[model samples]
Target chain A: MRTTKVLIVDDEVEFASTLSERLSLRKYDAKAVYCAEDAFAIARSNPPDVVLLDLKIPGMEGTEIGKIIKQFNPAIQIILLTGESENKIISENLGKDISDYIVKPVEIGELTKKIDNAMKEKEKLDHSKGQP
Target chain B: MRIWKKLMVGFGVYVTLAAIIGIFAYVELRTITKRFTVVEVADDITNIILEVRRFEKNFLLYKDDDTFQEIKKYLAVLTDDTDKIRKEIIKEVGTDNYEMMKNAIAEYDFQINILSKNFKLQKEFISKIGVLTRSIEKNLSGDVLNSFLIVRKYEKNLMIYRDKDIYATLINTLNSPKFATAEVNRYRSLINGLFKLYREEQSSIEKIRSKARNIQTFTEDLSKRERANITTILSRSAILLLFAVLTIIILGTAVNIKIANSIATPLKQLEGITKKIATADFSKRIDVRGKDELASLGTAFNQMQDQLQNTMRFLELANEKLRESRAQLVETEKLATLGRFSAGVAHEINNPLAIINEKAGLMKDYIDMSEDFPNKEKFNVMLNAIFDSVRRCSSITHRILGFARKTDITPEAINLNSLVNEVLKFLEKEILYKSIRLELELSEALPVIKSDKIQLQQVFLNIIKNAADAVEEGGLIRISTGIKNNTTFQVSVEDNGYGIPKEMLKNIFEPFFTTKEKGKGTGLGLSISYGIIKKLGGNILVKSEQNKGTTFTVEIPV
Candidate 1:
């Protein structure tokens, strides 16, 4: 039996609140936090299945949070949210270890699809590690 | 006109006076010379007769006493006196016309002296015969008759001497041709008639001598009077000539100065001003003091200078303003483009991200439901659902990339009429929802213009979007296009929207110059469209009437 969890981080209270509402309405096991510091505190207690990162946050940058999030929970799938359509730095981070990246004003329909793809990629990697 | 002619006439009067005086002086000179000639001749004849009377008296007193000795003394004295009078007459005759008068006077003097000598001889011989008359007292009348015979014997000799002198004077009259000497010939004829009277005993020799004395006195008075006349005329001529000279000098000098001022002074003043203007010192004004053509010309010159200065200043100010306005327009354009792209960047990334988020959540649910499925194929279906989600994510990425940078550019030949219609159709739903009635008046056969299609489409989309937002439901919008120059064209979009406020009219084309509610419009729509048209060698202009309508017309080159 597999248990899936999702984490969302951003500085915008509205975007985080709205995203949490939508995720819960759609039945995803997700949690939202406003800053990277609070996110680390929650992740140590219960590591998420996947992490959604915003690069333009006020505290620690999304890439910095992403690095820390991965260190604490390497098996977790990570998806970077970039407000810019073509940010090479964000995309480069997603390619190496993150499961995916999405540019904002993210369509609600598109975000859900990206989340599913990332979850499966994470699952495949874990399964391969188990087999080895 | 009258003044100038009057001055000319005044000058002419003075010149005439000078000329008349010159002519008077010339005529007076000839009259003076003529009067002098008559007086001078009368004086000469009078002096000669007086000398002759003295000689005759001396001969009568000295005759019998000295005989030859007395005769010689009388003759010598008479000869000296005659020579002196003859020399005086010759001196008065001068060289011009008196050579003949000189010869006749010389001959007459010699003949009178010879006649006086002959009378002295006869008087001496007759006084000898008077001594013998006492013895013959009975013949005493005979003796007295002898003395009478002696006097009678001298009568022929005296007449002869006077006749010779008269004939000599007549010859001088014919030869000298002087007017006063013609009187001398008349006197000579009178002397001849006196001799004839002495022969007739109607005139004695003494009476003839007295007549001669009167002729001499008359000649002297006439000659003296003529000389006085000549002196008076000469002096008058001198005085008149001197006055004429003085008048000519004074008036001629005045005329010279007047003419010099007329010709020189005005021309010299004009030349001075011309030099100043030539050197670019146009600040000076030529004084037009005279009421003449030259003064009018001076006024014209000053007016020309004033106009030139005004024109130069206007052009300079215009040039400065043009530079300033152009610079401001360019700065405004830069800000406009930046604002449009900035807002566009955010929406571009956000839309794709939203879609990805929703799709992923659906896929996650699918994967989680595998255990509850009745068949084993549910797991397989869940895995396929994951694959579909991945493909959808890729397309989202592509769409975000296209919208973000605004670099999906493709230029093509497109008619603006058709382009405007297409944009209007695409925005129909939004237009209807906003209660704006979209109208079309596309021109047929608008020229094919070359431009970036998708960019042009975006421009039209933004303009229509604003127009739609501005108007209430059912408010009208008109889209139009027109041809120009065979290869250039224009598109115009008009709407009965809440027209741009008067205060904001000037800034309508500026970036972020909008009255739209915050967060709803970035205000880059018109600004970006402006840049688009401008970059494609075209321009955008807006005409808006407050509360009435707004129209945006874009002109593009082919």
Candidate 2:
């Protein structure tokens, strides 16, 4: 199994820490941040292979944050987390991003599988670049 | 009674004057009549005295003794006549002095008889003296002259007797003696009696003259005094009458003013207040001025009007508040209905969008990784499904936007009867499926009404839906169109179905006041319909009785 780069971004500090620790055992280089600004900082610095974005964030909230980060690198994949059941927040905010969503209180193993799939996607890019 | 009092004074004065004057005049008339009768008696006495004196003159002045004897007979006749005059005079003048005058007259007659006897005896003496002493012619002349002188003396006695009442003189002379000599003493007694009579008569005349003076003086003075008193009384009575009349006039005017002011002032105030209130203004009140019953009555009337105005104001405010509350409630229910609808859309549209998104993302990955592979049918279904979900979402948003729009209608010519017929046609299948018999009494050539067509259609649809829900099998809904006024058209939708309950009737048009089961009716249909109808410059009225039917009448002015 190859190493997978996963970014867990949420304003819940304890939640992000616990989730990142769990992902570490699953062989994912998972990091966490409380805000879109820090997430962007970390993304530009280490550049995570896949971003796990929370829809509600303190600064530059997830919907617009997804757009800005996608503009920076469109090939970089994103999966969204939503705490609210309001369709307006879903359709109006996150609909344009075409990002996949998992309602919160997700299973840890299910998150790990999502990260593995994203890493494979990154690997295909690397192998293609090597062949070229 | 005032007249009685006034006439009382006049009658009293008249009675007093009549009584006093009647007595005074009676006394004066009696006295004057008595005086005249006395004068006539005195004149007769004087005539008898003169006749007696003339008889003595006839006996003495003639030289014949036979003539002298005839004169004595006449003297006796004159004496009886004088005695009758004295009795008649006494009967004529009714006084205590009547007996005095009568006695005096009898004595006068007695003196005349005595004088007549004396003259007869003296004549024989004179004839014998003429025979004794010769110088016959001179002696006859002397005898005639002496007889003439004696007759002249008797004439003087008669004048004195008549002047001083000889009858009274004679009677007084017989009663009191003053003469003293034999023949001369006999003559002296007669002469003394004569002198006494004259003195007594003179005293009586003096007393009568004094009485006449006193009576005349008193009557004349009293007449002047009484006249002055009556004049003063009349003037005083006149002043009192004038004052009484003025007092009556003044009091009458004051009473009239008091009555007019008491009535007219309050009445005028009431008229003004009533006029103001009749125009539906209730800002002013009348002050009750007097504590009289009528003033209290005014207070009560004003209070009643005040209460009526207050009640009217209260009703208007309550009705306005009710309308406002109904609007708020309609808005709330509208939001609630939108929430319920969106919830369904979220569950139905969003989850499918999620599936489409997942499949689309997988498709993109398959295409990216395996360049030679193409799953055409699968990708097409996925893309089509995604497109369809998106389209449904947009349509749902459009429906919500259209339903929630608060567009105000600009009025124009509309055929209300056609609008009603169109709505009924749109709803006829629903009505027929529900088994509600529809009746239409559309008036031909109905005038065009100025109103909102969409709003009218919604109202008709909602009312028909409500009627369909109310009626069981064999129920009827009748729609009638007519002209209400020159500028108004009326449409009535009547249902022979279960009517609204009396208590619920008041809140029928209020939002969320549905009698339908939960989730079947949001209860805002009627409220929104009513609001729309009202906004379109029209009125919707409902008349219903429980268990009988319901009727909705819509009036829209042209």
Candidate 3:
């Protein structure tokens, strides 16, 4: 079985590192980036199968970065983590091919479930494209 | 009396006085006209007497038939005139002289008739004597002729004499004898007969003249008396006219002044009151008296004054309330600005809280994985405590963010009792720390409603916190939930604490109105809860009394 590659992007260093370690323990290849620039650079160099994006970052908007990452590789699944519970930001990026949106202080289990579902959905799409 | 009635009375008095004066003048003039008749009667008497005298003179001078006829005509006229005058005197001047004048007139008329008869007889005697003298001239001698001449001379003397002395001398001469006894006796008889007739004629003429003179005198005396009466009447009428003019002027002026004073005095008072009212002295009122229009106006003005005073006080109270509300609005504006600022800061707080939560959870997971490392129990306890502390910190931050957040919540079907329990979870620690006994009477069959869950949660949380704050240590707080009606649900939070004063009850829900000390309360809890309930098509109501308990009820549609 191929290990699922995951990228965690957040302005909160401890949150992204801890969450990445937890994902690694759960038998997945996960890495953490602290800023939008690092996230973009790492995503272009090593495009992960799934990306966890923080909606609030210092340099660039999460939606903007998500759009750029999707353009770089349409197969990359982007999920947004936000401190805001506003549905407008989520609905605005519905057509941007984002995987899902989650509010802050969300359960680790719930986030993992979303990430696993997004990877599976991408795999299914890739397999279908590979089919007739 | 009414104004018109007063004016009518005034005019009535004036008209009555004028009528009285007019009646007096008319009566006096009438009396004067009646007295004037005496002068006219006297004038007629004077004219009749003159006619009688002229006719008598003519009769004596001519001894003609025409003269006698004139004398008879004049006598008849004089008699009629005197009789008419006497009747007029009887009617006007009373009967004192009327009877005397009537007798005099009757005697005078009889005497004039006899005088006329005697004059005729004298003419006849003269004719007879002429014949006798011619017979003697033809037959007798010188002595008889002398005797006849003496008789003729006496006869001529008797015819001419009207004076009593002349008449007596003539009569004596006639009686003297100068010839034979028989002849002398015959001549004497003739002369005496003629003489007797002449004396009677003279006496009758004298009586007629004397009576005419008496009539003239009586008429003159009556004229004098009647003239005096007329004069008196005319003068009295003139005086009465003057008196009437003066009386009319005095009475009219006096009555008019009385009426004017009655009207003008009250009117001036009313005008003064009205002026005071116009100058904004609404406290002044008019004194009403009588049943007149001015009195009615005074009553109306007094009512107006009361209304004006009441309206001014009402406006002043309303203005004060408006100013208070305006101040509250300014506080609301300040709260809005504070909400925006807190929202901006909430973002910074969330990132750190999330980091802390994740790191603590990771530490707990790592400890659980290496369960047998040195001091594993203490490490697990420390890790769990850290995780719990992080959870507590996140919860507090999340609540603050929720309060400041302007996020629009999608509506969803929610159970009210469950939402109330969820909000109570935040106050559980405070309830325990304060030693308050909480009672929940949530209805199990309470209907679900479509509303914003976050806002409802905020509303319940605010009400429960307010309830908790109101209770002392070991105080009781009771929360009851039930279906209010067919399509509404209600939640009531009650606390046994020092309740709001009666005077402050109305302002309890106003923004920035709080019983808590400054810096301990932002005063936005109940106000925000009220706003939230209203936004969900609901309302928040409060009931409180001093020294008792307070209850806040929230009603929302199902």
Candidate 4:
């Protein structure tokens, strides 16, 4: 079994770092970035298996960052995170390039479960595309 | 005066003047006619005198019995005419002149009678002389016969001419010696007497002629004077009639002009003011005078204008109030739209809450996994408290998001009274805690309406809860439901509580405008309720007085 690499992108530095540390403690390779530039730099330099993106950020929107990351690596799984529980935000970005989403004050167990499912989906796509 | 009366008065004046002129003309005509009658009578008298003179001349020239009878008949006619028209003649001439003319006519008639008698006596004397002369001629010689023939010739001349010289010659011949016999002397005396009678008749005829001349002169003078009087009367009547007509015309014109001005001037003023009124300038008023119809009309017009001005002022005030309300409505709608921003604000706030939650959960995770340490239990409890506080914050944020949420309307049949009761049941604990007396004046006549049941319940709950909150303990809160109007139903929640201050009442429905103490209200309750009612096609109104009470009425269209 391979370790799942998770990238956390949020304007809240403490929330991003603590969530990344929690995910690391749960035995997953996790990293945190505070802005879109750093997020894009880390995504291109070392692509993770799944990216956790906050919908609202300081500079660029989380969805725009997600689309740019997908352009860089089409196989990288993108998951949206939002503090807003509005169904509109979730429904708008659900089926398009993004794999899954979760509301904020993220539960560690539920986030791990969504990441594992996204990694499996990525593996399924990789195997079908003849990549081992 | 009134227009009609004024006109009637003017007409009366004109008619009276016309009548006066007519009467004056009629009287003048009668006077002229009488004058003409007097002149005719005078002329008839003159003609009778002329006829008498003609008969007198005939009698004197022919000495005929028929001529004398004609003279007497004419004299009688003159006398009768003078007598018949005596008063008229006296009126025309003086009484003394009329009497003198009558006496002259009588004297002329008497003289003619005496002349006729004298002529008859003279005729008898001539016949006696003829018989004497014929006897002398038979008994005397040639010389004496010649003298007697001469005396007879002289006597015949004296009788024919009635001259004094012929009478002297006849007397000398009758007294000649050849005629000295008693018969000759007697013939001489008879001839003398015949001559004397002829002279007397001549003098009488002269006297009658002079009397006839006097009658003719007096009658001619009377006729002339009567004619002059008629002419003067005619001229005077003409002047009087002209003056009366002129006076009537001038007076009638003046009166008519005054009446016309009295009527037309006011009418003209009314027309002018009416034109101004047509243009909506009600400032000017008719200057009314008198108790005429036009004055009353002006008063009525002024009253109508006053009413119109009042109505116009009322409309302007109403429009001002409407404008203010519209502005307030726009502000409320703007604040309602602020609910949309509440979603973003909630999202932003949730980030910090999420951070706190994660940090607390991370700390709890570390504490739960780590070995026992000093005050480890306290640290775990504090971390749990932080987590609980973050949860509370998230709940608040979710509530804010609910305001912005576009929830689907699930329309259902709703009975307002049952709904109100249901809402009251939810507030039962609060009501019990406050020991507030609740009175329900629910009407069964309320009809079931189709609306969003949950939203309507939220509106009523917000309003009733606000009512309960506004009151003190043991305060009375009355909840009543009824039909507000033909198309809407109302649920009024009245409370005997400390009412909102006047300044703050206007902003009560504004977003986040709340009088509640800190941490007790989010200030979104009433605003959210307003939004819901507005979406449900209803409205909420609040009436309050400081130290009195507050009433919140929610009206929903049925």
| DockQ-superior candidate, 2 or 3 | 3
lDDT of 1 by residue, B212-288 (tens): 44445444554675576678778878887888888777876677567556546666877887787778666777776
Runs off by more than 4 Å, candidate 4? A1-132, B1-133, B136-251, B262-329, B365-396, B405-419, B443-456, B482-490, B498-510, B530-548, B554-558
Clash pairs, model 3 backbone: none
- How much of the true A–B contact set does each candidate keep? 0.23, 0.00, 0.48, 0.61
Model 4 chain A, TM-score vs. native: 0.93
Candidate 4 chain B least-lDDT 10 residues: B331-340
* Model 2, native contacts kept: 0.00
Q: What is candidate 3's DockQ?
A: 0.40
- Give the local distance difference test score of model 4: 0.82
Query: Per-residue CA lDDT of candidate 2, range B1-558, in tens?
Result: 232343454455546545655665566556545444444444444554455445545543453556555545654553454354454334444444545444444454454444445445544444443342223224345654454335335534643444445444533442343212123233334444444444544454454334334323332333343445445555665565566555545654555466556767777888888898999987778777766655876899888997998899899999998997688567556555654565455434543443344444444444544545467656667765765554445434333333445454656677877788788788778787887788889999797777666667777888878887887788998989998756777888888788988888889887567888764666767876776765555678999988888998887656
Model 2 ranges off by over 4 Å: A1-132, B1-398, B428-436, B443-446, B465-475, B482-490, B496-527, B539-558
For candidate 3, the lDDT comes to 0.77
lDDT winner, 1 or 4? 4
TM-score of each: 0.42, 0.36, 0.61, 0.55
Comparing candidate 3 with candidate 4, which one achieves the higher TM-score?
3
- DockQ-best of 1 and 4: 4
How many clashes in each candidate?
46, 6, 0, 0
Residue B38's lDDT in candidate 1? 44
TM-score of 1: 0.42
